[model samples]
Structure formats: structure tokens, C-alpha cells
Target: MIFRLSPKSRRNLSRIIPYGVIWLFLGWFILTLEFLATGNENQRPETEITLSFGVLVFASLAVFIAGLLMGVLEVFVFKNLFRSKGLGAKIALKMGIYLLFMLILNALTFPLAASLELGTTLTDEKVWEKFWRYLGSVTFWSTLISLSFHILLSLIYSGFSDHLGHGVLLNLFTGRYHRPLGESRIFMFLDMQSSTSLAEKLGHQRYFDFLSSYYNELSDAIVEHEGSVYQYIGDEIVITWETEKGLRNGQCVACFFAMRKQLESKARYFQEVYGVIPAFRAGLHCGQVTTGEIGALKKEIFFTGDVLNVTSRIQKLCKIYGKELITTQVLKDQLPQAMADQAQSLGDLELEGRAEKIELFSLA
Candidate 1:
């Protein structure tokens, strides 16, 4: 079987790699400046530059390794603690912790590197003296300043990425959608059933809290199925996937059931929290769309296509058809054999605004 990274893992790697590259370049640039500032009187500039480049490779590699480790800690460990905190709190806490980690790493690594250069054991008196001397030097403080800048950048990027979906941040930087482009995509429009009544029953504030919990609970299944959350409009969430990704192992269809299962698993919690278990209906459709960047004040990647409207129409029909999940035949035909076999055809149906009739399926 071919190995593939889940969407979350790929997103984490995209976040982690930039830090290493930044450190590699920054380390080389700083070391070159140091050589130019404190070169031997007899040594030529070119010769000094060449020697500095040669020695800096090892140091740069060490810095890169440190960056990667720190990235892992920030992405996997610290991220969990950041969920409830505000931006200022997150930055301050990360800076303090990262500064301590960097100090500890530098303290141990400097001694090890020195011991290797002098060909002596770590317990040697010379290594201890050198390490203690370095603590008071300007270089040590400068290193801390560099690390502080790196941590701040990482935190800022992390916050932005979280706010604007991970893939969106990368695309914005790369300018992938600067020009309008046509592509095939699968979209799923999911909305809470009887949301108006539920809101009236629970009141505005309690309904908002219930909606938050509902979306949070279903997020795992969406991620696992490689779905990108496009938008959340009121009680409706629009999810999208690339054509190939959604078809793989019938993920588009499977995602619906997985989300249903997740909610069912959390039935008790929902019942206790809101005195009701939230239920949802979804419609899946796939087609071509023109994608491009839009908005001057607050930019976003916008998708313009009939498929979005058609998907919404299909979702609205779920109540009339009395089905939990409904999908277009165009999507059902492309699903895996096992998944496709479970589809119960609803025959040709007329959409609200379109003259053309469409074949729909309800997944069992």
C-alpha cells in the first residue's frame, strides 16, 4: 500500500519546516557578519568568508536541528494548551517556555561542541570554565535575542494559520489563487435539523454554546476524512475536498457516516448539556468551480460555481425526502463499490431553481 499523510499531519509538517529553513539561513548570515567583524589582521576577506562558511555549516546544522525540535514541541505539545487562551496570553506563555528551553539546549550543546573541539571529556575543568565564560559573553545574549524573534514569528504564524485554515495560509503566501482557476471539487453542505425551533427552545446564548459544541464534536471525523471546512453559516457548515481525495476509499460518502457515529457517541454529553441531541442533514455534490482571491479589506479564497447552489438545494430537499444524507448520482457513481452499493436511489428530482432534473441518492 502507498503511504499517505493525513491532512493534519501534512499541515503540521508545513508549519514545522519553515522554522528550520529560517534558522539555517539566519545562522549562516549571523556567522558571516561575526567573521567580518572579528577577522584576523593577516587574513584576506575572501579567505575569511570561505573559512566562516565552512565552519558555519556544522553550527547551522545544529541550529536547524534545534529549530525542528522546537517546532515539534510547539505544534504538538503547546498547541493543546493554547485553545482557551487569548493571543497575548498565548504569546507570552510560549515566549517564556521557549526561552527557557532554548537556554537549556544552548547550555548543554555549547559544552558538548567545545569538548569535541578540545578532545576532552565533558567533566574536564577547561570545558566548565569555557561554558561559564560563554554565559557572560555578548554572543549568549545575542543568541537569546535571535531565539526570541524566532519564537514570536512562530507564534504569530501559528495564530494566523489557526484562524485562517492551515491550507489557506500556505496558499495566501504562495499566491496560488491570485488568478482565477478552474478545478473540480466535491462539496458537502451540512446543516442542523430544526435549528430555528432548537434556538427558540434553548434561547440565543445557550443555542450558540450548543452550536459550538456540535461543530467541535464533528471536527475529528472531518479531519480524519481529509475534509476542508470551507465555511460555517449559522448552523450550516460547508466542507470541501479535492476530487481525487474525496473519491479515495469513498471518503466523501464515508465522512457522513463517520460524523453521524461521532455525534451518536457523544449523545449523553449533548443530552445533558443542552437537554437535546443535535441532529444534522447533509448533501454532497461535485463539479467545476472558478477559484480566486477576493475582498480588499479582508481577503479570502472564493469559489464561484453552480455546484455550491445545487448542493444547498439538495440539502434542503433532505426534509422532503426524509433522509439524513443525500448526494447527487454524479458523486455516488464515483464512490467505492462497498459504499456505492449502499446508495438507495431517489429517482429524478427537480431542484427549486433549475430547469434540469438531477438524479439523487440517499445513503443507508
Candidate 2:
């Protein structure tokens, strides 16, 4: 028998596994320190050593379990609970909620740890007595403090990972783009149709809210297609993908349609809330780009090449040609044959500021 997870599940698991390891190490570190302090190395009895070893094993297992539960709650349960709230409010709310959750977990684990030490059943009176006593002990407070500190660290990491895409953060930490490298990438320049008119109709604040909602809906499709958001400029979003990933099964093309379908599925919600269903246009092109990190105060992974310029020009032509989506022949040729066959040629069109005219295609 075999088991498999969807892309989203795999991403969630990647986040979850780290919490377990962090908590496990914290627990082991605390136990080992106490173990060393409580006894002499040459004079410890055999039974004491055995009991201490049992306590260490059981306590480590307990914290590891607690860590896994915390991961699930953080990833699936508490995520987005106060997504629209300010940072301070979100942090305060999560701290209160997680504090209570951690307390409950600690309470439950206490009796099991006591049972392992005493070699008694969890239901024994001694276990409950020990649990109550442990609650007030310095060790209990220390553990709580340690857990809080770790939680804060995790929150900071999550914030960074969210603001900068996870892939971008990993690359920055690993120094993968410290030196510039040229690579073939697919770029999609997507923009809302009639954004100026929509902004005028909705007003500034309302329009900002609308854009947030719009991007939130499209993000799922982009992630599913393994696209990284390059930038968000006003009502437009730029997405990029490695050539292999984008061309695989025509995922770059599929992502565009998927985003449209996602918005359409929420048509009633958008119409009821904002009095309009947003429409978008996109232009995609693939070619080599110089990729590297740049900046001192604010570092950013940037892609620089003529391909980006060409892609942007093609997207601008969407309004001129009155088309929903357009792509260059250079990219279309690399797509799956079935997808390529679906594209209707739009002839060689001259792009602004470029010497050569490039043949384009429109996906119906």
C-alpha cells in the first residue's frame, strides 16, 4: 500500500515537522540539565539511574506530542483567525489563546510524567497529588516561560515567511542568490481590467479591501500551480515559475484559467459585497533572466531581463487587442502540445522600445 499527500498538505507538513523537533530539543535540554544538577556522577544508585532514564524518555515523548498538537493548531486551526487585524491585536489574541492551550496540555502531561517517575498508574492518588504540587513548582513556571519564548520565536518566523514568500526566505538564508545567476523562467503579468474605473467607483479604502480579497482568492491557484508571486503592484500581480515547472502539463496556462474559475465560483459573494465581479488580463512569456538578491536596508530577490519587459508589453497589449490572455510564441512552443494547439496565433506584433517584433498567441 502507498500513501500520498496533495501539494497543500505537503506544504503544511513542512511547517509542522519543525515545531516537533524544536519542542523535543527544548524538553531534552531542560531534563538533562536537571538530571545533572540533582545527582552526583560517581555515587548515584542503580535504581535512581533507571528511574531517571524512564523519566527522561517519557518527558521527551510527552513534549514531542505536545509540539505536534501545537503545530496542527497553528497551521490549520489558528491560522488566519485574525488575518485582517493589526499586528499588535493579532499577537495579543494568539498569545492569550495559545497560553490557555499550552496550560491544558501541560496539565495533562504532568500526571503521565509523574507516573513514569513513580512507577504508578496514572489514576493513582499519588499522581494527582504530584500533579498539583508540580503546578506550583519552579520547574513548572520555567517550562511555561520556555514555551512562551519558543512560541514568540515561531510567530516571528511565520510573519517573515508570510511577508516574503517561503521560497524567497529560504533562498536568502541559504545565500543561493548571493551571486547573480541567469536562469530560464516563465513570467506572468496579470492585471485587473478597468482598475482605474473600479477604484473610482469603490473609493480608496474600499478599493484596497477589494484588491486584498481578490488577491487572496487568486493565491490558491498560484500555489497549486507552484508559482511564486514576484510582486504586487496596485491591482496587478506578477507570478513566476521555473521553466520546467511552468511547462509541465501547461501549468502556467492552467494557473490563469484556474484563477478565473476561482473568482467566478465566488461571483455571488463579490457581486453582493462589492457590486462587481472583477475581471483580469494576463500575458505570459518565458526566457532567461538574471536572478539575484539586491539591497542593504531592504533586501529583495529580483529578476532582470528583456523577457520581463516583453511580458509586460504583451500584457499591456491585452487592453489594445481586447483579449483576456496573451502569450509569446517563444513560450507557447515549449508548452504541452495539446495546450499549444489550443493557442490561436496573433501575428508578429511590434513591442514598444524593442527592435524585433515577436509573434504572439491568444488562448481561447
Candidate 3:
């Protein structure tokens, strides 16, 4: 059977591959060794016989196929069903999906091992008795295995995402940045507006909660616009993307506006919950930056150059210039015509600690 995956689904599928590879190899080794160690290979448990093989080629294929199927199905669940639901609801949904998929797998593989004999050429009473026993065993083991796998996978993905952010883990591990490299990238510095006053109004703990919810609200827009979160510093977030990805559909610009719209829509909700509405100021610029992995104790893929400096300065100018979003002419020049036309001149402006004046623009 052929299954087509959407881009988002493909991304989710890619995340579990490393774990799946290790699981496949480990399962094959343990099962083969255990069967051989039994000393009576002819006599096997039904499930054991199904996965065992006389030839290494067949054994490898069986292990690979089982691993591939389970991995794909579980990832599908993660991508489609695992939304930002409540904990109780998510767990119940996952258990249901696991039980259903496991039964489907058992149906397909039992016959492949020619172990479907339990129901064939047998009296109805005998077949029903065997069927109940088979169902009971499969249900017990499938639940146990699925729960363990889900827990392990969650931990792996969480730890990976927390430290590395999204979409850069494999690249780092593959030595994609062994040496300093130069590449053109779009950078945005998003900072919460009136942060000092807001902090005073809400105090420390409440202010931290506000920042958390504020960033959480922007997470969807970032992913939807296909942007990578470079870093989070205090109350500000830094986002970056390779030139092509950022400019492909003008995500670099559109993302900022999308975030504004999202917050606007949630304005009433925020007011009711936090007793305050949050606003943001952002700056955009594009240029070449030196990129490489930095630090030994706390290793990081770092980007360094004037591009970041310029972007940060522009963000600071938002309040000074009385604009919510600010961008340099350098970035506007690279945007597509449709997006470029949205920019109207804000005139040349001098940035702090910089000798050269920059031509700036604000989007309509």
C-alpha cells in the first residue's frame, strides 16, 4: 500500500528514524540469539516463530518490515493526533490508537508466518477458544510494548527539542558545521513591548508567566511560517532562516504579521486570563553571518556577524521610531515584489553606536 505524506507529516516521520534504526538492529540480534540459544529451534512460541527465520536474509527483512511499520504508524499518530491536547485526553487517545494498530499488525504478520492455522479447518468451538487466548495475549503484550515505546520516544524527542531547538539536531551531529561557514540568512529580533512596566505591573513570577504564554502563542506562527527559532533571551526571541527558506513565500515578513493577528484574535482571552494584553516589537535584516558550533561544556551551533547586530539595533528602534515593526532596506531589497511593495520608506535613520546611517521601512 502507498501512503502520501504532507510536508509537516514528513518532518514528524523523520524525527523517530534514529531510534527506529537502533530498535530494529537490537530486536533482530536479541530474537535471533534467543532462538538459537533455546537449543530446540523447531519448537517455538507462536509469536516467536512468526518473527524467526532459518535464513539470515529472511530474518533481517522481517525485523526491518516490523520496525518500519510500527515506526511509521506511531509517527502518524504523533503528527496527526498528538495536538496540544490535555494530558488525560492525549493518553487515552494514544492507548486507543496503539491497540487498534497493533491488532492490524498482528492480522497481517500472523498469516505471513503461516500461523493463522488456529482458525482454519477447526471446529467453531475450538477456534473460538484459541481466538480468545490469542486476543488476550496480543492485547497484553501490545499495550505493554506500546506504552514503553511511547514513553521512551517522548523523552528522546523532548530532550532533543529542548536543547537543540527544531530541525538542527541531525545537522549538528553529522558535522555539518565543523568549520566556520558564511551564509546569507534572515534574522528577526522579537521583543515584548513595555516589558519593564509590564514586569512592574505583574511582578516577577507573574511577569515570567506572561512571557511564557506570550511566546507559546507565537510558536504556531513560527512553525506555520517555516521559521527556525534561533534562541530565546529573557523576554525576547531570536528567529532566523536561510535566505531561500525565509524568502520563498515571504515568511520572514509574513510571520511577524501572522503573530500580530494571532495575538489580536486572542486579545479577549488574554485580557480575561492575564488581565493584560501583550504586544511585541520586531526588527528584520538580512546579510551573511559566520556560522559554526561553539563551546565545549555547553556546545551550541552559533551564528556570529553584523547581520545579528543590525537586526537587534533595528528592533530597539521600534519604540524610538514609533513603529511596531522595523526593517532595513537591505532586507526589503531581497523580498519578493509583492512583499517589497508592502514596505514604505521610514527615511534614513542613525542607529546607536553605528557610524553609517541606514535606510529603514515599515510594512503597511
Candidate 4:
């Protein structure tokens, strides 16, 4: 049952379990102190001490149960609330809500536990006497201590959890922490031609392994070329390099072809081992894009605007035109005169959304 916890729940449990265990030990320590001080197995100590200890035990148990329930709730029920928001905001909101809930639950449990005392003398006379005397001492001190402990735990849990969650989500969303935005850049989208068919033939696990290797190789190549990976959509990888470099030297384009040859070699190796090879098609274009973090609780880096959309459209055209790689006129215009001759024009092609036809070229 514990293993069945969702990723988010598991994260919450990780934060709560350590503190909960420590408090459990502390509760036991307090009980031991009470026992040693009283020197009685089953008898109450001083009326004041007994009430104080009882309140301490009750609060400790309340905290434990509340932490468990709240951890689970945060994992499953409130998971979406943390999605799409920044790490700081998400952690703060969750901890604030959980702490508030704990306060309410602990407050309600006080009267109930007091009412259900067994065996001991807690009559109207004794109870009234104990209540007034112990109330100021036990209630104030314990509440302050519990709240202090809870705040400390919350801060630690929120800080560490937010740090990790934010790092991972940032990678998943934008593929980097510091994303450059609102700039003209060369965007490339590479996709495996028949990934669905390959997946069907290879089975889920094997196909996933193939995708892992494919993405790894592609990412390595992109990084080597000073390109940033924006995101992946199934078998497709969206990447970007600054237009200044891409246009000035055609280094990014050269890197793309070089990576293709490396991938071809990898395909041959996979074919020898698994009797199958995956083919890929890629599209490149140069234009402006807007990039930034998006979502509320589970924040992600996002790239939007025409360049990203057009790059993807051009990649789709690769499948239609039966080409390995395609580039737009924007890319051709930017390339050096010597490098420009290496590319062959495919003339103007009408894209799905654009009213004006886009000029296409094939990499030689």
C-alpha cells in the first residue's frame, strides 16, 4: 500500500516521515520522563503533571496522524493544486493549508480526549481544578511547542522539496533553468518516421529503451552544437540555437548532418542486435520565439510563437516530401555564400496554415 503512493505523495512522505519519526521518539522520551518522575506504573503523577503529559501525548499523536493524512492528501487529492505554479508558491500554499488543517484538528481533539479519560480521577471538582491550573501552563506551552515544531518541519520540507521539484519540472518543461526568450533563433525539430509502428513491433519496454537511447544521442549532439533542447513530443525533439551563430557560420546545420551520420551508425548497430532500425526526419528554420516558464504549481519552461510552430510544420513536411531533412528560405538566406551552394532548392511549398507559400530546400 505504501509503495502504491504516487510520485507527489512519495515526495511528501519523504519530508514528513523523518520529522514524524523524530517526534515519535520525543513523545516516547517525554512519556519515559513522566514515568521515571512519577515512579508509578499505572498511577497519575501530580494532577498538573498528568494533565501536562496527557496534553503532550495527545498533541504528538495528533501531529503524527495529521502529517500522515495531510501527506497523502497532498500527494493524491491536492496534487493538481501544486501543478503549474512556481516551486516557492506551491510549497508555501501546501504547507500553509496543511498547518491550518492540523491546528483545527488538534483543537477539536483536545476536548474529546479530555472527555474520554478512563480510570483516573478527573471529576467535576478535580477536572475544574485541573483545567484552570493546567490550562495556562499545558495548553499555552504545548501549543507553542507543537506550532514551533510544525513550522520548522514545514520550512525544511518545503525548501528541500521545492528545490528538487522545481529543478525536475524545469528540465521537463523548458529543458533548462535559464531560458532565453523573445529572440530570433534557429529552431529544429527531429522526429522518427515510423515510431508508432516500431513501438508496436518492438513492444512497449523495448521501444522505450530505444527512445531513451535515441533521445540521449540527439541531446548529446544538440549540446555539442551549442543548441538548447526545448522539449520532446513523443519521438520528436525540439531544439534551438541562437540565430547569430546559426546564420553566421552554418555550424548548427553542419552539426545536424553530423549527428544524423552518428545516428545512422547507431541504427546499424541496433539493426545487427535487434534486427530493426529507426529512420528519422528533421526540419530547421530561423525566426523569433517567445520562451519562458509556464503553468501554476508545476511550473515548466515553455517556448511559444511562430518560429516554434513553423519549425514543427516544416518537420511534418519532411514526411510528406520523402526527405531526410528540410530547411526554410530563412535558414538559406542566413547561411554563408560558400555553404549556401551545398543546399538544393525545392521551390515554394504551401504549408497548412500560412496563406503565403514557404520556400523549401534540401540539405545536400
Model 2: CA > 4 A from native: 25-57
Residue pairs clashing in model 3 are: none
Structural similarity to truth (TM-score) of each candidate: 0.89, 0.89, 0.73, 0.52
What lDDT is obtained when candidate 3 is compared to the true structure?
A: 0.72
For model 4, what is the C-alpha lDDT against the true structure? 0.67
Predicted structure 2, TM vs. truth? 0.89
Writing each residue's lDDT as its tens digit, candidate 4 over 14-82 gives 545654654466556655776697664435222233445566667568666765665556445775676
> Could you tell me the lDDT of residue 242 within candidate 3?
90
lDDT per model vs. reference? 0.84, 0.84, 0.72, 0.67
lDDT of 3 by residue, 220-290 (tens): 88877778888999889999989888988788999999999999999998898888889999999999999
Model 4 residue runs over 4 Å out of place are 1-181
How do the residues 268-326 of candidate 1 rate in per-residue lDDT, one tens digit apiece? 99999899998999999999999999999998888999999999999999999899899
The true-versus-predicted C-alpha distance at residue 113 of model 3, in Å, is: 4.3
**Residue 187 Cα positional deviation in candidate 4, in Å, after optimal superposition:** 0.7
